[model samples]
Target: MKKIYIEIKWAFIYSITLLAWMLLENTLGWHQERIADQWWLTLLFIPFAVFIYLLAVREKRRRVYDRKMTWPQAFLSGAILSVFIALLTPISSYIINNYITPELFFNAMDYSTKNVGMTQSDANEYVLLTTYLWQSPIGALAFGLATAAIVALFVRKK
Candidate 1:
């Protein structure tokens, strides 16, 4: 169960870091002023991805697997982290969207309409769909698991 604990700890760290990063970005108006225009912000995922991989693999290699880890073990650790992230995302999403910077939601809608060529109605629907569906728990789970599977491939020690 130590491995499970490690995965959970890392997951919590990663999730919190993600929330902080998002909050900082939004607070700085990056999401509002620059995100749509600057495609490079999307590359931020690469660092987070590498961080997740390193945390999972390094912990496995150091503590649980003891210098060597199998692919299945690496995958399992990543999956456990994913599940935790999936579980926590909803609460984080709610807090961030509701309390931290609710304006981003509306800003997103406007950006969608103006830049993405979406009509007002379509933008509204898109926001509703993304908020209720794509950013929801199920969507988090799906994305988390997919990320875990891919990260595990590189994280596996042997």
Candidate 2:
């Protein structure tokens, strides 16, 4: 439990750093400008990505006896992170749906209805699918694993 807390703390740190980076870069300059609702959504990914990396390490350490954890540890850490992120995915989506961009639903529906090659019915179906994708916890976990694996392969110490 203590270790999970520590890892979550690190994850928050990682998430905040990501937010700071984006703020610095102006990529997520929406909140400051008051024209954005998905800033929270963007920010949510930061800790999620970090959590995946850290948890993957936890996974690795759990299986290994060596004092130093290895690549497999990193890989599994990502998987663990992914599951956690998935579990918490609702918090962000709920915010987005209820507050951040309530209009997003209609707006996206409108755009897709007009812009895509698909029929309105098909477009609506796709939109719903995309919404569900955003809602899915498993997707988050899988992405976490992928991102963690990439980062681990390059970032882990030799």
Candidate 3:
């Protein structure tokens, strides 16, 4: 359990790091100016997810499995870490959307209107739907589990 706690701690720290990076980008207006319509920014989620799973599994292997962890153990550790991440997502999303980048929604709506050829009502609906999906804990759970399942395969030692 100590190993799991440590992994969860790291996961929390990583989440904060990601939130800070996002806030910095938004504060600089990068999302609005440069990447508004680009999907590249979505790539950022991969590394964070990979690191969370990899580090968790590695730590578990090192401390608990004598550096020879089985797939089940690796998967379990990664899944547990993902659960922590999912639990933390709502709070982080709230802080980021409400406090850090309240203008993000407007920017997104504008982008949708200009780039996606969306009507005002359609853009508004798009933002609201996507935001709700992104912030939804159910989505987080599904994504976390899938990420854990995939990343565990690579991180497992034995």
Runs off by more than 4 Å, candidate 3: 1-3, 35-38, 129-136
Give me the candidate number with maximum TM-score: 3
lDDT of 2: 0.55
- In angstroms, give how far residue 40 of model 1 lies from its true place: 5.3
What is the lDDT of every predicted structure here?
A: 0.71, 0.55, 0.74
Model 1 over residues 90-118: C-alpha lDDT tens digits?
Answer: 77777777876677768778888888999
Taking all chains together, the TM-score of candidate 1 against the true structure is 0.81
Candidate 2, 31-57: lDDT as tens digits: 334333443656556655565465546
State each model's C-alpha RMSD to the native: 2.6, 6.2, 2.5
Q: For each candidate, what TM-score against the reference?
A: 0.81, 0.61, 0.82
Model 2, residue pairs in steric clash: 55-77, 56-76, 56-77, 56-78, 57-77, 60-73, 82-141
Against the true structure, candidate 3 has what lDDT? Answer: 0.74
- Candidate 2 segments exceeding 4 Å error: 10-67, 129-135
Looking at model 1, which ten-residue stretch has the lowest summed lDDT? 37-46
Which has the better TM-score: candidate 2, or candidate 3? 3
lDDT tens digits by residue: candidate 3, 105-144: 7888888898879999988977884566465567667777
